[model samples]
Each structure stands twice: as structure tokens, then as C-alpha cells.
Target: MNPLYSPTAERADNRCEYCHAPELVFNDLFKVEHIVPVSHGGSDNTDNLALACRSCNKYKADFQTGTDPDTQTTTRLFHPRQDEWSQHFRYEEEIGEVQGRTPVGRATSDRLQMNRAAQIAARRLWMQLDLFP
Candidate 1:
């Protein structure tokens, strides 16, 4: 890892801050991503960094906000350093889905495919093994 990139995996408990997927489950190590992109003037400060899965990092890119498909409105995505995860998303064990509790959550979910098939399957397995909440 680059010196500029802190080990956010430890801070995030080996989880992707965006999707909460365990970094250990991925084929390779997760990325240390900027909460805001450098192209967008985001800095290299650790406070602005997050551990991210390739899927979430690639999907999020430089976007800080996203469109809510259900409402057709633009809303801010969840901020790992600033926003409370539980305030926006709740893990539904019954369906193994990350349910959006607010517009921000909903938009973030849609933009990042948080409830995509693969993630849902992973969540189900994680839940069964007592690895997920």
C-alpha cells in the first residue's frame, strides 16, 4: 500500500466502508479510496480515505451524490467518515439485503448496487456463518 494510503481496513474492521463486505472475502486486497476524488479536489488525508471493495470503488468513482431511482431525485451518497452507517442502511437478515432507511441510503444503494445478486448471496452466506450482522 502507498504511504499516502492508510490501512482503513483495520479502522473499518476489515470491511469495505461502502458495502461492508469483508476484505478477506475478496480475491485481492481492497482499495484505499478517496471519499472525494482528487480530480474533484479531494486530498490524501486519512480522514478522507476509506477501505472499499473493487465493485464499490469502481461504481462510486468520483461521485459524492447519486440519483434515487424510485423518486427521481438526486441525493448524497453515504459518507464513511461523516455519515453513520446505521442511520442510512440496515442489514435485513431475512432477505440478506441492505435496506435503505433514508433517501441518501436509497440513492447510495442504487448507485453502488449494494443489493446486487452477488452481494446478496454473499450476505446470505455471511449471515449463515455468523460473520454478518
Candidate 2:
């Protein structure tokens, strides 16, 4: 486990900062990920770290920005430390989907594959159990 896991997870309320997936349903602990990759000049400071699920971490990789589908322009990904989740994304209970409310949200959603089929299926189940937003 990463040295920052405990703190990062706690800061994120044991949920994925990007996808907001609760860690309680998973067998493994969430990952402590860099909001900005070291390669891109990000540091290991707590401010740059976020808790993430495997899926979001895998797709986010080293990406700092993504193309917003609406504007067709490059936009910075949602920064958990600097951006409020509700300001950018919304959970649509009916579809078990996270809807992007702004350019940053849209880009981050698409880039992280947050609406993949498996994600939607799991989200629906989580919702039914009252374990999700």
C-alpha cells in the first residue's frame, strides 16, 4: 500500500475522488493517486494526492487533461483538491450514470471511462443498496 493511502482515503471519505465509487464495496483499498503525475511536475505532497478506484486510476494514468466532448478543446481534468465534485458532476439515479455539468467534468468523465457498461451496472447495484449517491 502507498504510504499516503490512509490519509488520502480519509480525505476522500473512503470514496474515489474522481468517480465517487465507495471503497466499502471493494475487497481492496482504494489507491492513492497523484492528481498530477510526477512526470508532469506534480509532487507527492498530500495536496496532489487523491483516493481512486482501480478503474479510474488505470484510465487516468498520467493524464492531466482531457478533450471536452462539448467544446472539442483540451481541458484540465477535475482536480479533487481544487475542484468541488458537485460543481462539475452529478449522479443521475435513474441511469446510474455520472453526468458532467461542465467542460472539466465532461472531459474527466470521458477520459476516465466513468460511464462504461460495467461501471453503470455496478453503480445501479450500489444505488439499490443505498450505498451510492
Error of 2 at 70 (Å): 1.6
Q: TM-score for every candidate vs. truth?
A: 0.92, 0.98
Question: Which pairs of residues clash in candidate 2, taking residues 3 or more apart in a chain or in different chains?
Answer: none
lDDT of each: 0.86, 0.94
Best by TM-score: 2
Model 2 has an lDDT value of 0.94
The superposed Cα distance between candidate 2 and the true structure at residue 11, in angstroms, equals 1.0
Off by over 4 Å in 1: 4-6
- The per-residue C-alpha lDDT of model 1 at residue 129 equals 75
> Per-residue lDDT for 1-133 in model 1, tens only?
7564446777888788977887766688888999988989999899889988888998999898998877989998888999999999998889988878889998998898898898899989887777787
